[model samples]
Target: MKLRQLASECDEGPCPTVWTIDEDAEHVLVQGFKVEDEEALATMKMPEHETTVRTPMALLKRVAREHLT
Candidate 1:
């Protein structure tokens, strides 16, 4: 699948970013800091194929305003 960058918080290196699937605008791909908190992670049951990341609320709002809207 192709990807189009929607927004990024960094210029160089790994940072919270959002991407849109070129083939489907209804869904988005996210890049964020890896969540390694054992206590927090243990609170939920996630399938082996799925994982989680952490991002800021401001970034999410920006995505909603610019893309989702």
Candidate 2:
């Protein structure tokens, strides 16, 4: 399976991570900064692994659907 890019990162280090989506929208890879420190943010290239969350898109849709009704 191939994953597609839904979002992009900053030009340099310690930027908001990119969001990605697959063809079926079943899986989602969310990324971003873990901490908010002026000095540390400047030196980091990406968000910490613990900060990112990968989940199923279908589950999200289902929850939304249920909530709407």
lDDT of each: 0.87, 0.48
Clashing pairs in 1: none
Candidate 1 lDDT over residue span 1-69, tens digit each = 999888888788878999999889688988998988888788877668988999888888998899778
**23 Cα displacement, candidate 2 (Å):** 4.8
For model 1, state the Cα shift of residue 23 in Å: 1.3
Per-residue lDDT of candidate 2, residues 2-23 (tens digit): 6654433445664344333556
Candidate number of the best TM-score:
1
Compute the lDDT of residue 34 as modeled in candidate 2.
42
Give all TM-scores, in the order shown.
0.86, 0.29
C-alpha lDDT of candidate 1 relative to the true structure? 0.87
In angstroms, the error of model 1 at 39 is 1.5
